[model samples]
Target chain A: MDIIVTELTKSFAGHIVLDRFSAAFPEGEITCVMGPSGGGKTTFLHILMGLMSPDSGTIKGVPSRKSAVFQEDRLCESFSALTNVRMVLDKSFDCGEIQAHLDEIGLGKDRTKPVGEYSGGMKRRVALVRAVLADSRILFLDEPLKGLDDQTKGHVIDYLKKHFNERTVIMVTHDKEEVDAFDARLVTLG
Target chain B: MISTMFRKSRLEKAGAVFLALAIWQIGALLLDRSIILVTPVAVAQRLFTLLPESDFTHAIAFSFFRIVGGYFLALLVGSVLAVGAGHYHGLEMILWPYIHAIKSVPVASFIILCLIWLSSDSLSVFIAFLMVLPIVYTNMLQGIKSTDEKLLEMAEVFRMSRLRKLKYIHLPHLKPYLLSACSVSIGLSWKAGIAAEVIGIPDGSIGEKLYEAKVYLSSADLFAWTAVIVLISVVFEKLFLRGLKMFFDRLERS
Candidate 1:
């Protein structure tokens, strides 16, 4: 069954964000959630990711084993890229696979350096790499390429398209170009 | 940049010590009364002479280990209590009154109360433990409370293990707070511990020698013993803090 939201409502400080809004995210498909600023794009993503609860709503068919690239990098700043990626993996996990992905994302040369020293775009790719590498049935991306240049963005989009072919992906993005690149089913909200 | 800062701090510390000793020497010379104010040289001579006696080593070891042991015990128990209190508000509420009382009451009063139940030989350990516990506990709880909510939420969604959550998220948040607590509390514990020993007048302890110095009108012995306490306290603080710094350095570099 598809992940479904019915009459989801949320408010903060007497201001309503999502009010009786409803949507569906089909399983095993790339879905893009799009909205202008202050349109509850982040709020919706957070609620769907179970980072928060809707004030009043019912969400059905949300899967376990979820992975996400939060709006912030949320990477451990004191650790290397490989360690950050390896953190979510099992004890017998190999670093070679994560290393190759980091190389593909232009972070191979800097993979051993602490994330604290990484630029914003570099950190974003590390976060993306972490999400892609983690074992999860559903992946959530919140503007995962927000700080990247077009060339790097293209490189990362290619990576996402290559690795996440069958995994359920929900991307929160404002850029129509990005949604188009993913060939994603779109849901625009307020 | 870090190395330069370290060297600068060391130099500053040396300069401060020199200035303090110069002032002390000048005061002793002007007073010209050996019984009232012992010169720095006289104190140093007394220290060297005191060191050869077997009782000196016994006194140093007796008080040092018991006091430092109490600190280590408090560190362990305080961290456990802080983690518990951080997880349960009701437990924290129950502990809050006692913690506040411990913090507010004078160290002397606690020593006297403890003496009624404990032998003088063991008084320093209990007093030291009591002095260190609340500080470590309170700071650690603050550390836990101040951990980043977003990171914890990330951990939750990732289904991260408890060990990983502690290592990756909680440890980093607690490091500075715990280290600062160690710094602030180590000095306090030593002072309280020694004061307890003095009041209790434990045999084979530095406090006994101090009591002897006071009753004998020996200013040089008093200054020498007092200097010994300061030196021991400072040396222990530096060594323990250095170990912590090394651990953090390895953590950050790794």
Candidate 2:
């Protein structure tokens, strides 16, 4: 089912962030939400992810099983990259499979080191890998490639495209190049 | 390389200890009064003579069990209460006054009051538990309170189960706080527990030996028992903390 948002409005401390905002995120398609900072892009993603409630409006069709690469890395800092990926996988996905996925993302050498010790780009990669590898009907990514270098970003985008081909994916970013690279349906918020 | 490093550290520690002993021996000789201060040699001789006595062994075992028991109980109860308080604001509010009361009250006063209500044998356990509970509770609560809100938000987004969130997120976040609390509380439990024993003078306890030493004016026995308490306390603290770290390591690996 497609995720439908109708008249969704939200505010923080009397400042309106989202006002009667509505959009439909298509199923099995990559959708990108773009807007200036504080234009309610992150708020919209948060509302859909059930992290925040709208002041007045309705969101429908969001799947129950969801995964996300948050605005922050949100990787378990004390755990290794492999362990962080393995944490979200179902029992059927063994450690070897998780290691393979991390290796594909260019994290093969740093798989054993805790993510806390990793560079920002490396941690971002781990977070992206975790979101894509988890079993989820809907995947949400907020600035998923923020700290990555251009070369690493291209590789991550390719990996995401290959793996998330069939899942409903919603991404929030300010970069037009990222949106173009993912070939995503575009939604702009003022 | 590792063994060499270990040997170097061991030698350094031994040299420091020897220097301390030399200072103590010099001080004792200058003081020239066994009543005020006993020499380390005298204390060691006293300890050797007392080593074969059944009472000596019994005293060591008795105090060790009560103090360590109180510490373990406090650890379990404090963590449970802190978790409850973390989950419920109302519960935290209710616990505020009790925790404050325990923290502010004097240890000696508590020992005396507890002796009236509890058997002398159990007084050390109660006192030790009382001293340790608030410390562990406060630290663990602070840890729970300071957990990353963003990570919790991520957990919600992923629809992770409660157990997974705890094992993967909460426990790992709380680790430093728990380890720190254990480090501080282990020594405190022994000190406060033994202080209570000394006051209550429980039968077949280190406190009783100390009391006998005082009554009979045997400074050697007093120094010997004091050394024994210090040694046992250090050994137990090292062992308990090691065990805690090992348990966490296994949890992380699994």
Candidate 3:
């Protein structure tokens, strides 16, 4: 089901972030939100994911199951890269499946090393793999390719496009190259 | 180069200890009074000879178990209370008075009051427990409070299980706090346990021997028992902390 937002309003301490906002996030399609900083791109994603509530709005057709790659890597620092991915997954994902996902994401070289030792781009790839493998109907990725080099970014974008089939994937980014890479539908906010 | 640095530190420690001992021996000799301050030689001789004595062995065992038992008991209760309190401000406020009292009260006063309420046999255990509870609770509570809010947000978004949150998030945060708590509380537990025993004069306990030493004015006996207490405390602290470190290392290991 598509997510429909109508007249969504939110403010923090009398400063408005979103006012009379409306958008339709097409179901099973990749949509990218782009705007200047403080334009409520993240705020909108947070509202859709139930991390925040709109002061006055009606949102329709959001799925119950959800997953996300937050702005920060947010990987379990002390756990290995494989364990970081597997923690959100259940028994259906076997050990081989987890290893395969991390290996594909370019973390194969040192899956045994803890995520705390991983570089920023490496940690982001692990977070991406985790979101893709999760059983959520909707996947929210906030600035998923910020720290990565162009080569790594291209690889991660390809990985997301491949696994995100038939799933509602919403990404927030400022980079036009990232949006073009996914051929994603654009939603601009101010 | 690393080995040389390590050996240099070890040599410095030995040299410091030797100088202290030499000063103590010189002081003992200059005093020319055995009752005033027993010589290091006399204390060492007394310590080795007491090993074969059945009563001395029993005293060591008796105090050892009671003190260690109380330390473990405090660890269990304090950790549970701190975790609970960290989750709720009202619960922490409710518990504040009790923890404050435990911290402010003198060990001697607690021992004397507890002796009136409890039997001589259990006095040392209760004293040890009382001395350690607030410390472990304070350190663990600080640890829980200091947990990263961002990681928790990530966990909540992923809907991670409680067991996984504990194993991955909470335990790592608590490792250093728990280690410091054990280090601080273990020494206090032994000291308080012996003090209680000396006051209660429990049979076949270290405190009883110390009290007997005082009553008879046997400086050699007093010095010998004191050395034993120090030795046991150090050995147990090293072993327990090493085990704790190993436990955390395994948790983080892939």
Candidate 4:
């Protein structure tokens, strides 16, 4: 099923963000949303993820199970990267399986260390790993690779593409390289 | 360098206390009166005698249990209420007036009014609870309010379970606020609780011992009981805060 946004309108105070914006996010495909700063790119994603409601709009086909990597890493600083991931996963998830997912992102060795101690790139990978590994119908990535160096970014992008396969991934970013890397369909907002 | 500075501070504190004690001894000697201002030695001696007395021990036990019990109860209730209000703005609005009233109203007034309503024996508990509630509630609410919205949004999108959200996000955020509130309110609870006892003259309470000391004009007994109260309050605060820190440490690790 496709997630459909119809004439989505949102305003903060008196500033218009999204003005009757319409778009289609097809099932099992990556849709990369791009825009200038304060262009409602993040707002649109937030609405799609049900974290925020559009002022006037109808959204359809958004699944109940959703996951996201916010613009900020948003990892629990005091907790281990593994523990932060485990908070979202069900108890039925095996520790070995979770470790394997972390290992895919080259974070297996320090999964037990507090994410507070993790470097910027390492933290981004942890957030990405957490989002991809969770059981979700749609994965929202808000600049998930924003702060990473080129080498780490390429590595994580590969791992992300592998795991995000055949899943509805809606990513918001300003990077055209990331869009081309994922071969994602682009939706520009103003 | 930090450890050396810490050691230096500790030594300075000890020297200051010693100097203050010496000044107090000289003042007492000049006055030549135990009834007015007794020497620290006299107070210490009185403490040793009181420690062996059944009445003194019983009073300590009585006041200790009620006051500490009241503080814990307030902590529990305040935290629950703060969490509730954090989730529901309407609930916070409803609780606003009462919280403000508790904060503004004089403790002595509450003690008197409560004495009319409650029995003398339970006066300290209620007073302590009343004193500590607003402090805990306000600080905890501030903590809950200041929790990172970005993290909360991530939690929401991931459909994180409530228990997990609390354990991973909320508890960590609340740690500093809870520690700060506990440190501050514990002493207030003790002071307010003992004051209530003093006014209510609850039998077998430290307050009653103080009252007796006052009536007999025994400054030594009065000073001794006062010192005992300070010691108990400080010790309890240290132990409770340490336990709270340990709990947070274990939570972060687990």
Model 2 over residues B17-39: C-alpha lDDT tens digits? 99999999899989999988889
The CA lDDT at B159 in model 2 is: 69
Clashing pairs for model 1 are none
True contacts kept of 2: 0.56
Q: Kindly report the root-mean-square deviation of model 1 from the true structure over all alpha carbons.
A: 1.7
Identify the CAPRI category of the predicted complex in candidate 4.
high
Best by lDDT: 4
Candidate 4 or 2, higher lDDT: 4
lDDT of 4 at A182: 95
Residue-wise lDDT of candidate 1 within A1-190, one digit each (tens)? 5899999999999899998989999988999999878989889889988888999989998888889999998988888998888888877878788899999989999999999999999999999988998889899999988999989899899999999958888899989988899999999888
What digit string (tens of lDDT, one per residue) describes model 4 on residues B1-254? 99999999999999999999999999999999888899999999999988888888899999999999999999999999999999999999999999999999999999999989999999999999999999999999999999999888888888787888889999999999999999999999999999999999999999998888889999999999999999999999999999999999999989
- Residue-wise C-alpha lDDT for candidate 2, range A1-190, written one tens digit per residue: 8888899899999999998988888899999999999999988998898888899999889888889998889988888898788777776787887788888998999899889999999999899888988889999999998988889889988899999959999999999988999999999886
| TM-score per candidate | 0.95, 0.96, 0.96, 0.94
Error of 2 at B158 (Å): 1.8
TM-score of chain B in each prediction: 0.95, 0.94, 0.97, 0.98
Model 3 CAPRI rating: medium
Which window of 10 residues has the lowest lDDT sum in candidate 1 chain B?
Answer: B245-254
Candidates 1 and 2: which is better by DockQ? 2
Across all models, the iRMS values in order are 1.6, 1.3, 1.5, 0.8
Error of 1 at B183 (Å): 0.8
1 against 3, candidate with superior lDDT: 1
